[model samples]
Target: MQESLRALLELQKTDQDLHELEQYKVDIPNQLETMETVQSEAETRLSDQESKVEDIEKNRRQHERDLQAAQEQVKKYQGQLYSVKTNKEYDALQAEIQAQKNRISELEDGILQLIDEAETEQETLETIRGETESLIERFGEERTTLESRLSAVDEDVAVKMDERKRMAMRVENQVLKVYDRIRRNLRGMTVVPIKKGACSGCFHVIPLQVVMQIRQGRRLVSCESCGRILITEEGLEY
Candidate 1:
C-alpha cells in the first residue's frame, strides 16, 4: 500500500482502540453505582428486620405489663368479695374478678403470640444479617475489582491515545486531518477495506474501475458515498 494509505489504516486501528477503551472507562462509574445500590438495599433490609424484632420485643413487654395489671385487679376484686354486705354487691365483686381473669387470659394470649412473632423476627433478622454480611463482602470485592478494572482501562486508554497520536503523525497532514474529521463524524471508522467491491464502512458499492484501483495498492482512494478512505484486502497485505 502507499505509505500515506498504510499510515491512515494504522491510525484508524489505533483510533478504534482508543474509542473502545474510552467507552469502557465511561462505563466503570455506572457499574460501581449499581453495585453500591445493591449493597444499600441489603443494608436497608437488614435494618428493617432489626427494627421489626425490636418492635416485637417492645410489644411483648407491654403485654406482660398488661397481664400483671390484670392479675392485680383480680386479686383486689377477690378481696372485696368478703367485705360486701348485700348479695348484689358480692355478685358484682365476683363479676369484676371474672372480668379481670378474662382480661388476664387475653393478655396472656397476646403475650404468647408476641413471643412467637418475636422468635420469627429474630430468626429472620439473623438470616438477613448473614445475607447482609455476604452482600457487603461480595459487593466490596466487586467494587475493588471494578476499581482495578477502571484503573487498567485508564492506563490502556492513555497508551492507545498516545499510539494514535504517533500513528496520526505518520500520515500526511492533510490526509490525517480528513481521517480525523471523518472518524469524529462517523464514530471512529475513517478508513475501511473494500469487501465484495463495496465500502465496508458504509456498504456503498464501488465501481469496477475504483475496485481495480484500490486493489492495486498504488494510491489512496476515498469512497464516493461515505467519503471514507478505501483499501482492499490485497492492498492491506501489500
Candidate 2:
C-alpha cells in the first residue's frame, strides 16, 4: 500500500506539471491574440487620423478658393463705384463694395483658421503613424518569442503526460481507481501527507492511533473528513 501510495504521488506530480504546461500553451495564444487586437486598434486609429488630416487639407484648399473669389468680387464692386451717375447710385455702389470687402475679410479669417486646423491634424496623424509603426515592430518580436515558447510547451506537455502514465502504471489498480476518482471529484491534490498530526488536504485532525498506523506504512489510510489518501512524508520521501 505504501509503495502504491508513493507511486500515486509521483503520478499526481506529473499530472500537475502536464496541466500547467497545457494551460501555458493556451495562455501563449491568448497573449498573441491580445497583441493582435492591440495592433488592429492602433492601425485603425492611425487610419482615422490620416483621414482627418486629408479632410482638413481639402477644406483648407476650398477656403483658399473662396477667399480668392471674394477678393475678385471686391475689385469688381470698387470699379463700379467710379462710374456711378448720381449720389444715390454712388451710395449704392459704396454699400456693394463694403459688403464684398466684409465677405473677403470673413473668407480670409476662415482660410487662416482652416490652415491652423490642417497643421494640427497633420501633426496628430504623423504621431499616430509613428506610434503604430513602433507597436507593430514590438508585437512582431514578441510574437516570434511566444511561438517558440508554444512549441517548447507542447514538447514538455507530451513528456509529462508519458511520465504520468508510467507512474500511474506502478500504482495498484484499486488504489489508482480511488485516486483518479478523488482527483476527478476535486480540483486539487488527491493524496496528501500527514502534517502537524492532521490531514494536510483539509486540515482535519487525526487520532493518534491512525497517525501511528500511517507512520508504520502497513495499510492504506484515508482522512475521514476530506476522504484523501494520507501518507507519512518520511515514508514517501524521494
Candidate 3:
C-alpha cells in the first residue's frame, strides 16, 4: 500500500507537469494565430489605400481630357469671330468664346484638386505599405520561434505522457481508479500529504485514529471530510 501511495504521488506530479505542458501548447499557437491576423489586417489596409490612389488617378485623367476639349472649342469660337458681319453676331461669338474659356478654367481647377488628392492618397498608400512591411519584419523571428516551440511541445508532451503511463502502472488497479476518480472530481491533486494533522486538500482536521493509521503507512487512509487519499508527509519520501 505504501508502495502504491508512492507511485500515485509520483504519478500526480507528472500529471501536473503534463497539464501545464498541454496549456502551454494551446497558448503558443494562439500567439501565432494573433500574429498572423495582425499581418493580414495590415496587408488589407495597404490594398485599400492603393485602390484609393488608383481611383484618384482615373478622375484626374478624365478631367485633363475634358480640359483639352474645352480649349479646342475656344479656338473654334475665336476663328468664327472673323466671319461675323453684325455687331450682335460678333458679340454672341465673343460670349461663346468667354463661356468656353470659363469652362476651361473650371476644368483646370478640378484637375489640380484631383492631382492634390492623388498625391495625398499616394502618400497614405506608401505609409501603409511601409507599416505592413515593418510588421512582417518585426514579427518574423518571433513567429518562427513560436512555431518551433509549438513543434517542440508536441515532443515534450509525448515524452511526459509516456512517463505518466509508466508511473501509473506501478500502482494497484483499484487504487489507481480511485485516484483517477478523485482527480476527475477535483481536477487537481488526488493524493495529498497530511499537513498539521489535517487534510491539506480541504484543511479538515484529522481524527486521532486516522492519523495513527496514516502514520503507519500500512494502507491508504482518506480524509473523512474531503475523500482525498491521505499520507503522512514522511510517506512521500522514496
Of the candidates shown, which would achieve the greatest TM-score relative to the real structure?
Answer: 1
TM-scores, all models, native as reference: 0.91, 0.87, 0.79
Q: Quick one: ranking by TM-score, best first? A: 1, 2, 3
**Candidate 1 lDDT, 151-212, residue by residue in tens:** 89988987888888888788888887777777777754778888887888889999999988
Write down the lDDT of every candidate, Cα atoms only.
Answer: 0.84, 0.86, 0.87
- Name the weakest run of 10 consecutive residues (lDDT summed) in model 2: 229-238
Residue 198, model 2: lDDT of 86
- Looking at model 3, residue 207 earns an lDDT score of 84
Q: Where is model 1 more than 4 Å wrong at Cα?
A: none
Query: What is candidate 3's lDDT per residue for 66-182, written digit by digit as tens?
Result: 989989999998999899999999999899989989999998999989988988888888888988998999889898888888888899999999999999999999999988888
Best by lDDT: 3
The root-mean-square deviation over C-alpha atoms between each candidate and the true structure, in angstroms, is 1.9, 2.3, 3.3
